[model samples]
Target: MSLSVWVPIVGLLTLGALFALFSVGIAPIVGPKRFNRAKLEAYECGIEPSPQPVGGGRFPIKFYLTAMLFIIFDIEIIFLFPWAVHFDALGLFGFVEMVLFIGMVSIAYAYEWRRGGLDWD
Candidate 1:
């Protein structure tokens, strides 16, 4: 609403936009343009690239499952951090809620463990 409040927000946003534009614009000139078989190949963690079908080949279902589990746990940790910071304000009700939340997470974890979600082999 006010100049003092709006100016800083707009200024920061403009700065961010300028930085992004500069990086994307200058990168082609400053960065390498060399393209060979190795450079064109998709990165596969430090492993040698293997020849595959036209569309980069099929991904294993296990990779999807593992990624979903990682995202779930990552979100769970995010909630925990905010709850911990406001622990005092939440008091007994928050404590009970957190316990229930933790219980649900534990159940899901146990189910995954029982179903071999944690197994690599």
Candidate 2:
């Protein structure tokens, strides 16, 4: 690349570094120094942290499986969106491929449904 191209990159890097330095240096002097039980305690998913159970509060296997299923379906949509955006360029072969992918996913979904993978309780 040319020197002109590098100028903006270097300028942005310097700007980021200056911002980080300023935030870190000024925060200690300007920001709140409060430390108390409520502020220090962990908060997650808008819920207060509960007392730990025995055996380190093991979550159910169903919870992990549901999370994985959500991620897998989410990724499938991510793949489909690009193909849909380029539908005309991809033509018939892409259409067939997408159909097959959906068929497989449908089968998986049906299997899971049959096995009660989608049940809440």
Instruction: Give one clash count per candidate, in the order shown.
Output: 0, 0
Candidate 2 has its poorest 10 consecutive residues by lDDT at 45-54
Candidate 2 lDDT, tens digit per residue, 1-121? 5799899899999999999999999999999988999998886533457886534776655656677678769978988999989999999999999999898888877866776678875
Off by over 4 Å in 1: 42-59, 119-121
Task: Tell me the lDDT of model 1 at 29.
Answer: 93
- What are the TM-scores, per candidate, against the unseen true structure? 0.73, 0.61
lDDT of 1 by residue, 24-107 (tens): 999999998888987778886444666764346766556666776787698789889999999999999999999998898888
**TM-score, candidate number 2:** 0.61
Instruction: Quote the lDDT for 15 in model 2.
Output: 100
lDDT of 1 at 102: 88
* Clash list (residue pairs), candidate 1: none
- Best-performing candidate as measured by TM-score: 1
In angstroms, how far off is 121's CA in candidate 2? 9.9
TM-score between model 1 and native: 0.73
